[model samples]
Target chain A: MTEIATRDAYGKKLATLGEIYPEIVVLDADLSGSTKTEFFAKKFPQRFFNMGVAEQDLMGTAAGLAACGKTVFVSTFAIFATGRAWEPFRQSIAYPHLNVKICASHAGLSVGEDGASHQTVEDIAIIRAIPFVKVLVPSDGIETEQMVEFLAKDSGPCYLRLSRAKAPLVHEASYQFQIGRGHILKEGSTVCLFTAGFITSQVLAAALELSNQGVSTTVVNMSSIKPLDSKLVVAMAEKHQYLFSIEEHSIIGGLGSAIAETLVSSYPKKLVRLGINDEFGQSGSYQAVIDHYGLSTRGILESLKKELKL
Target chain B: MKKRSVAELEDLACELRILILKMVHHAQCGHTGGPLSCIDMLTALYFYEMNHDPENPHWENRDRFVLSAGHTAPALYACLIKAGYIPKDEMWGLRKLGSKLQGHPKLNVDWGIEMSTGSLGQGMSISNGMAMAARLDGKSYRVYSLESDGGAQEGMMWEGAMSAGYRHLDNRVALLDYNGIQIDGFVKDIKDVAPLDKKFEAFNWHTLVIDGHDMSAIVAALDEARLVKGKPTAIICKTIMGKGVSIFENKPKYHGVAPTDDEFKIAMQELGDQ
Candidate 1:
């Protein structure tokens, strides 16, 4: 099984797009190497702006460039990009609905060894509440590449969450990515497991384990969390007896809460949410953190079995 | 556009000041002091300095202006109306519900507002971006941003200052409305953002200090800004909190308050209005 980090894919895709879209400009706040915008900076130095540790300035500058008809993409750590510069993001970019792509890297507990200060578990909730801003969490490298290409051509504010750790490929190279859409990776009857970001790989492994135990399950990759595929969520709710949501972020405002909001409004179903239960992350290896948080394959399988009473 | 005489510019400033006072008084809410202090520069820019087409607000090659001290939107709205970007009838709708004239300037490109600004210290960074865009496209249009002494206290302002200076954004010109008053009290009494010119000079900007109400000085400083190369310029306009209106001048109480009916009559009278 091939593996690649979404941040790497973002850098490669942006460098490729820079060759095609002359209007595409990139800005980073002293984290180009970490966030992988350094690739574009190296290739297109004239178009890249190193804003230097000032997130507010980075966001406002991006808004200014976008207003002047430049397709601007800004990058930084999730905590600083969405937390430190939240007001500028809301007033300058999101309020005006500018064509700025905020592709923040090192999201969720996957940012291991950096501690809770670096991990942004509430970024999705904070960004999604802002009107006119689309939120996307691509499950794997292939989807991330396609999502970057899609956002480059699309206009308006978008927040794309990427992970630091690499994960197994969940989608084929020929997979077509669209904004506000989700994909079903597998089919089952008794239970449905919905996941996003790199955690989908674990959820897929859990589904395979459940099949061996004779518990039928379906796996749905809900990459687009903002303009959620409510139709597909409703269909899954109507078909499966139990629905489960898993993510590497806080359960409060991430994939779980998004699914709960849709199900409670349209199609009520028995659902279980699996994620960090309203707690901050600690410094540890990525796999150790996942195991401790019950996001590993074994932990997910055990949680599902307990929820399904099997 | 033909240049207006110093006396004519002063008269136009007085008229625009009256318009600002009336709009804020009718709305019953606005920053009275800063708008009054900054209106003269806005009038000069719109009426004389900038290369803009009010008939076509989104003209591609037009110069850009960002009001960093966005609480002064009343002044901007008055200038926009006087410059023909908006009609005089829309002045009544300032800060009203569903109005295009938001409390702070919203990005209504068709109305000639370049960027939505209200949060202090963010506008200069945006101005840098517009200047960089002009350089990228090899366009000759300039960018101007106006901020108050209170707004200069924000750290992001310094970040933008460093960036503009480092990048040598010669197309960008920033004006500081040095009114020395804020919502709480005098800027010196509160945070003390003094020696502003030296600070900007240290940041690699071509610095100028001028009497904000002097129309000739304002025009000359703007002219000097265009001649500057390899760096941005900062014009520190020393101004009273409320210029031209005697009752509100240098009054901190009027920083965020609207004029009462009696005060409005006094203000209009002071500005040589009915």
Candidate 2:
């Protein structure tokens, strides 16, 4: 399986897109290299702005550039982009519905070795709460590339969450990407596994293991959290007896909450939400952290068995 | 309309102050002191300095104005009215539900408001982006932002100041309405943003200090700001908390409070409108 960090795909794809879209301008809050926006900065020196280490200034500046008929892409760490500069994001970009893409990298516990201060588990929840903001959490590199291209063409405020750790590719090269659409990676019956972000790889592996245990499982990659693919979720809820949501974020306001919100309104189902149980991340290797947080394949499989009473 | 003379501008300022007061009084909520202190600068910008057309608010080449101190939306609404962006009748709808005129200036580009900026310290950075875009697009339209002394206390404001300076966004002009007062108390008492001009100068901005209410001085400073090259300009306007109403002038108590009926009557009389 081809492995690549979502941030790498974001930076590379953004650089490629810059050649075609003259209006595409990039800004970073002094995390160009880390967030992978350095690729665009190096390629389009004139168009890229390093707004120092100020996230608020970065957001405000991006909104300003967007107002001037430029599609601005501002990059920073997820914690700072969505947490430290939330007000500017809410007021300047989201309120006016500016064409500013907040492509934040290093989201969730996968930002290992940096600890809780760096990991942003509530980004999706907080950003989704803001009006006129379309939240996208691409599961892998290929999806991140597709999301970057989609956002480049589309106008309005977007919060694209990218990951620091590399994940196995889950899509084909010719896979078509759509905004607010979820894809069922694997077909099954009895139970459905809803997942987003880099953790989808683990969830897919868990589903394969469950299949071997005579429990046919469906694997759905719910990348688009906001303007959620409710149609698909409702359909899955009806077809499957048991449901589960897994993510590398807090259980409160990430994939689990989004799915719960969707299911409770239309098709209420008892879902086993798999994620950090409202706890801050600790410094460790990506795999170590995932294992410790019970987000690994074995952990997910055990949780599924328990939830399904198997 | 031709540019008004200094005396005419002062009279216009008084009329704008009356409109702002009446709007706030009607709503029974708003930042009173800052708006009155900043009205003269706003009057000069709307009436003479800015290259904007009320009939064509989205004119591509027109100069952009951002009210960073958005609590003073009454002042901006009055200016928008005077500039024919909105009808005078709508002034009464300030801060009302479903009204175009929000408590903070929301981005109603059709009505000529470039950005929404009730949250302090963020507008200057937006101005920088606008200026950078102007440079990128090769357009000569200038970007102006009006911020308060209290707003300067925010770290983002300095970040914006640094970026504007680094980029040498000469087309961007920021006016710091140093009314020396904030919501809690005097700005000096709360957080001293004194020696404000030196701070801007240190940030590599072309700094200028002037009397905010002096129409000719405000107009001249704006003109001088345009001629400045290789750096953004910050015009520090020394102003009383409330300029027109003698009772409210230099009073921190009137910072965000609307005048009572009796005070409104007295304010209108003092402003020579009632």
Candidate 3:
């Protein structure tokens, strides 16, 4: 499987789309090189603004540009963009429903050696709480490209959560990504694996192992966390007795929490949430962190086997 | 829009002060001192300086005004009402439930509000964005932002200040309402933002200091702000916290407190119902 960082895909797609949509303006808070917004900045130097490590100003400036009829895209590390400048994001952009796309990169424990401070497991939760914001975490590079294209033509504010590590391509080139829709990777009946972002690839591998072990599992990508695929979640819940949610974020308010809310309200079921507990992440390699947290393929397979008694 | 003379502008400011007092007193919960301090500059911007149309509030080529110190929303409402952007009757609905006249300025361009701001330290960045947008689109319109002394203490204000100065946003002008009083205490006692003019100058802005209450000086400073070619201008307006009514003037207690019934009568008397 080919692997590409979602941020790289976002940068490439955004720069390409910039040629098509001249109205698209990009801003960054001095993390263009890491966030991969450097591509857009380098290509469209005149339209790009490096706000100089000022996340609050980045959000506000994006709102102002959007108010003036520019389709703006602001970028920075997830910790700074969603945590340091949360209010500006909520007040300036989301409240007014401006046409600014906040593409925050380096989300989750995938931030690796940067440790607990830089690794944000709560970006989804905090950003999702803001009204009028569309929260999207793409599963792979192709999906990231498609989302970038979709959001450029779409109106209103959106938060596109991207990761620093390269994600395994879970879909073919012909894959169609849409807002508020879940993509079913593999179908089965006994168990269901609902996952999002980079965690989907690991869940896919775990599901395949479960299939070989005679414990058939279904794989669904719940990328759009805010306007979640409730119908799909309900349908999957009805088809499978063992339902599980996986993410690289905290189990408290991320994809697991979103799915749990959907299930309890519409169709109640027992959900095994596999992700970070109420503890902070530590310094290590990307795979090391995920493996340590039981999010890797083998770790997830073991957890599933233990839960199902298989 | 016809430009008003200095005397007419001063009369308009006095009328606006009366309206502000009425709104604050009716709401019984809104900032009083800051609005009273900034009304003259707001009057000069809406009546004499800004190239905006009340009828066509969304006109693309018009100059943009962002009230950074949005706690003083009454000042904005008074100007919008006078400019005919909002109905004169809406003044009574200030801060009421379901009112467009929110405690903080909400972005309703039809009401002549360019941006939604109440949280301090945001308007400066928004103004810079607007100025950048104007430059990107090849539009020659200017962007003006109103800042209070309390708002200046925010770190994001300096972040935005640096960007505007670095970008050389010549079409941007920021007016600081240097009234010295905040909700807690005098700004100097709490966190001094003195030598503000020198600070903007250091940031590469054309800095000017003038009496905020003087209508002629307000107009002249804004006029001078427009001629500078390569840098944005910062016009620091020295003002009294509550300028119209002598009793409330410089009284920190009146910063967020509404006038009492007895105090309202005295204020109305002092502002003169001419």
Candidate 4:
């Protein structure tokens, strides 16, 4: 199995698209190296703008370029991109529906050792509230490449959340990526596991373990957080006896909250959310944080066994 | 559009002042002083200086004007109407729901609005982007932005200031409306943004201080701005909080408030219906 960080894949894809699309420009808030936008910058120096640690200017300038009919990609840590300069993102870019894609890396707890200050667990909730902005969280490197390609051709404001750590390859070369849709990685009737982003690989491993223990489990990768596939969520709810939503973010306003909103509105069912409970992440290795928060395979299996009394 | 003479431009500015007062009085909710303070510069740009076609507003080579002080949209609206970009009848619809003349300038290039701006400090950066775009396309179209003192208080303004100065965007021009008043009170009392010209100078901008209400000085400053090279220009226009109407002039109370029916009559009398 191969592992590649989604940010690495995103940088390669964006640089490749620059050759195809002359109008594509990239902006970063002095984090090109960390965000992996250095690839695009190194290839097309004239088209890249290093905004010099000014996140507000990064967003505002991107909106400005997009206003002039340039497809702009802005990159920074998720904390700074969505939290520090949120107003600029909202007023300058999203409100105008500019052709700017905000590809923020180091999302959620995967930022590791950087602590709670850099880990943006509330980014999905914050960006989702803004109208005309599309939100996406790719499960692996392959899906990230496809999503970046899709966004280059699509015109409008979008937020693509990428992880700092390498993600296990969950999709094969033949796997197709679609926006506003969910992919069912496995099929079972007893329990349905809903997950997205870097946590999808962990959920899949847990599902396999649950199946071996005589608990029929299903796993669905929900990469599109905004414009979510409600139809698929409803269908899964009706088929499975127990449904769970998991993510590498806070349970308040991320994947768990989104799935709960969809379920209660159309198909009412019991939902158990597995993620960081209403608490901030602390400084630690990525694996340690996920394990303590019940995001690791062993922790997830133990929680499932306790819940199912198996 | 045909360029108007200095006397004609001044008359047009007075006419715009009257239009703006009426719009604010009717809307019963809008900024008054900021619009009056910046109306003359807008008039100078629209009637005399800018190379823009009202009929062909989206023309590739036309100069772009961004009203960074967007609470002053009433002034921009009046200029757009006079420029034949927007219908004269829309003046009555200012701040009304379902109207193109929003409380702030919205992005409607066809209406002669280059970009949407209400949040301050962002437009300067946006203007830099437009200027850079022209350089990339090898076009000579200039970008003008009207920003206010209150807006300059935002940290993003300096961010944009640093970028424009560092990039040496000579194609960009920023006109600061040093109106000396904000919603709180006198700008100096609330927070002094004094030495504004020197500040721009420090940021690598060619600085100018002019009487904002003087049509000749406004036109001369804009003309001088175009001659400079290797740097952007910031023309710091020292202006009254309100101009044209005596009752509202130099009064900080009128910064964000509209006039009453009785006060409106007084203002209309002061501005002269001619």
Candidate 5:
């Protein structure tokens, strides 16, 4: 069954982890219910601390917990979790490479009515700049669940950017994810469609349309942007004539830019970088904003038809 | 461990000042004034109060030191070197290429440093995090942060202060170097942070106002900080900016700017003789 929501998946996963790992602690800036970290809070009251609308203190307290050899999962809105408390993560967590997971919910334009102030599009770029931080944007509910457990077990600072809206479960329950490796779910190499996060599902739909038009394509789930799957991308680019990268964030300095930088330095190809195209997203329903900004599956098909001369 | 005597701590503070000045002079640049003003407090912690070992800085039982007023790194670096935490000669390469000493105090390059702190008003939050972590672990080690009075005006500092007080973080001790001068001008003339004692007390911290220059007073307050069982302690030390240097003392501009060669010679001659 497709999961209710990525936030709901996070709730179930956090509760499961809390049961197994006694050293796991949950910290939320009063967004426990919204972010789905309330699962862990309910299961483990002593281990969970609702920091109450204080992002800076929340980040620091997470750092402190990590220093004491506990796996600390700090949950809040993406904007406040990554923006206001960036320094503490830089100074205290990433610099020290502590065992802290900065789990942020409602990433990108999916954060609906709260508008531009709360929707975090630049988070990937901002977090990717930090030397030792690992950025993870899981494609769906199942991946969010798997990645939370994966990051908790990995002994370093990691960010799990969660989506608020429900998404199609593209991967099977047994699907395992490597921390820095991208998986090529669809394989044929006339052109490579590369992407990450919930948007990868859109890329998959675009690939199906391109296939019927007799243009072969390869699709990659670029889950980890910082330690990108350069080897896989280079191989695909060498095998293909064109490269297409997409995301729910800016085309500048995000997954697309990261892949482009790798390809340009390694194996350059004809590429189209797709997303919000360096503009802030507006406040509206998820579908309205996606349609308004031309970041939908149809947008991907249109961009591909233009690139492939369909 | 035996506590340092008042006269002994006083003489130690003088030695620390002389060492700090020479360390900066070796590099020919550093924020000397603030460091000079805060050395007694730092000396009291490293030399007397805090639980740490130069041999094993990451020791689980060792007390943590977070320098929130990170620009005064020269002073901390000098004291670290003299006390044998960092190599003595590494002091010469303060901000040069590949040197552990960046403009601000960052952690892991050296043993005693717990976090990398450069931007103002940040270390308090980091220190609070570490203290809360220790509390959760049921650890006995205390976390202490040294922050400047002017830097304390950042809203984040108050946020951290509120968190510390609310959590009842008795294991944390934040020392406020109430040195009146910031880089722009006298703190009073620029952005007055006066009525500091009342301000910290209002934040739920046990406030202790004392002479930052007096070694005995600093030691006493640190002793008192240990006595406050369930609440964090904020030691507000009223200090003269550029205290030891005759020409630079009480001058706001000297907060970041170092002395010229002739001025350095005179300052050196005066400090060295004393």
Candidate 6:
């Protein structure tokens, strides 16, 4: 329990938030333990509901709770939570801006052994395109905790993207994480690496490797992908001569595209983007898939080196 | 919590219908049939039954209304404007690009619209969540949702129904516009959702069968729904498609058809001095 998966962090934050707000309700699609909402379920059984394995109904039910002024967080894996239930989330939640937080686990390559089908590389893009949804991808365990608490009282609907794998705590316990603000992890001049979710550390590792090879990189833990932390991103891009964005998503509409959009509005730099090259992944081991798809930390370093002519 | 007089409620319903027609006609698109079927129920809730504030749509204690039969958005939109939840001018912009009035009910376009409902069966489950939430919070507000009988075939609607009943959300009220016709043909032929009352009963819901277009019957059924306890209530209001308009009434072809100018004119004349 000490070094918990980010999924369990969701339950802890939700239970804490629920104690404060009577209207807070938690829903799970039979993944209460997996998504860590089981904690809330046990503590506040009346306030928690298990909508079985039906993701679509689960989403609709959360929207219903939101309709009555209850701040509801629905738990499920990222792929089924967003993909299977996208329409209800579209009409009942996002379109209406219902105050339901879709707290999903097993996001990105962190889902590991479940393979590409369960890994949600496109969850951000799918929800970000929605009209009124706020997309939050936390960098690490502490940040994930902070985000769940923040979204609890937030005015509109939000999607809390989480990781299946355990990540080292990035921010200090007292460190505050703002929903739309980007956190500056490390600062340098030659290159700026913008990334989100679990990939924050992956890109950071790549940047560090590049640093040892005589390149100074500015790494931004871009947690709020929808808002893009435009001011910091633009400023970082302006200072760095080159920009590289990486994520555990499709290169087309993921964090990289969002960074490109922000940087385009201000500073224009020679940019390199990396992720799934617009293709669905296959079933494979977690480490094997990361290695095969060239998404591991070493992969990122190698790709950046090749792109920068290292 | 006092009820409005029959005459006032009837007048509100007519006014709402006229407003919906005018907006749909001006916007050059809107679903006309289900709105006609739902006006009475919407009027009963907004003007009489539900506890709500027009000024603050998101007021926590306000009674929630979800139009599960989302194509009937014009009816809900018209009632919201007429009741002062939003400005009346907003209706004219219905279905227009950049307008708050969307082709289907959506929240991003407008504040008063509760949830975006276009796909048929999603709303009832949402209402279940709302009602269940109210119960959990020990709140006085109730949730009301109306789904089309055509929408009844969807697996999720029944899922929500069974769950709402299982949870005993007695404060939740669901109305069905049992007008029979779907897009391709009658529900009996396309997909029979008959035995709906028994289905709900088996789901542990207190059920009521009423004439959908009858003001007295609709209002009385809602009152009875309020008194029921230990289980949710669903009123199966039998109605005719395009109610009150002779030209298109009960016609399946008019399900998604935007009436032509000629059809609109005849329909307007048939509605008679609204």
TM-score per candidate, chains pooled:
0.98, 0.98, 0.99, 0.98, 0.95, 0.89
Candidate 3: regions farther than 4 A off: none
User: Candidate 5 residues B1-274, lDDT tens each?
Assistant: 2467888877777777777777776677768788888888888888889887787776787788888898998878867886788887787788777988887876762446667777788778778877877877788999999988788778778888988888889999999999888888878888898898888888899999999988878888988989897799999998888888888888887788667777778877877745
Residue-by-residue lDDT tens digits, candidate 1, A202-301? 9999999998899889999999998999999999999998899988888888888999999999988777999899999899998998899999998999
Query: Which regions in candidate 4 have their CA more than 4 angstroms from the true location?
Result: none
From the highest DockQ down, the ranking of the candidates is: 3, 2, 1, 4, 6, 5
TM-score of each candidate's B chain against the true B chain: 0.98, 0.98, 0.99, 0.98, 0.95, 0.95
Per-model C-alpha lDDT, please?
Answer: 0.92, 0.91, 0.93, 0.91, 0.83, 0.82
DockQ of every candidate structure:
0.88, 0.89, 0.89, 0.77, 0.60, 0.71
lDDT of 4 by residue, A150-169 (tens): 99999999999999989799
Q: Model 1 segments beyond 4 Å from truth?
A: none
DockQ of 6: 0.71
For candidate 1, the TM-score of chain A alone versus the native chain A is 0.99
Candidate 4 structure quality by residue, lDDT tens digits, B25-60: 999989988999999999998888889999898898
Docking class of 5: medium
| Alpha-carbon deviation at A283 in model 2, angstroms | 1.0
| TM-score of candidate 3 chain A against the true chain A | 0.99
Worst 10 residues of 5 chain A by lDDT: A1-10
Residue pairs of candidate 3 with colliding backbone atoms: none
In candidate 3, the second chain superimposes onto the true chain B with a TM-score of: 0.99
Docking class of 1: high
Clash pairs detected, candidate 2: none
- Tell me the lDDT of model 6 at B158: 86
**Per-prediction interface RMSD?**
0.6, 0.6, 0.6, 0.9, 1.8, 1.4
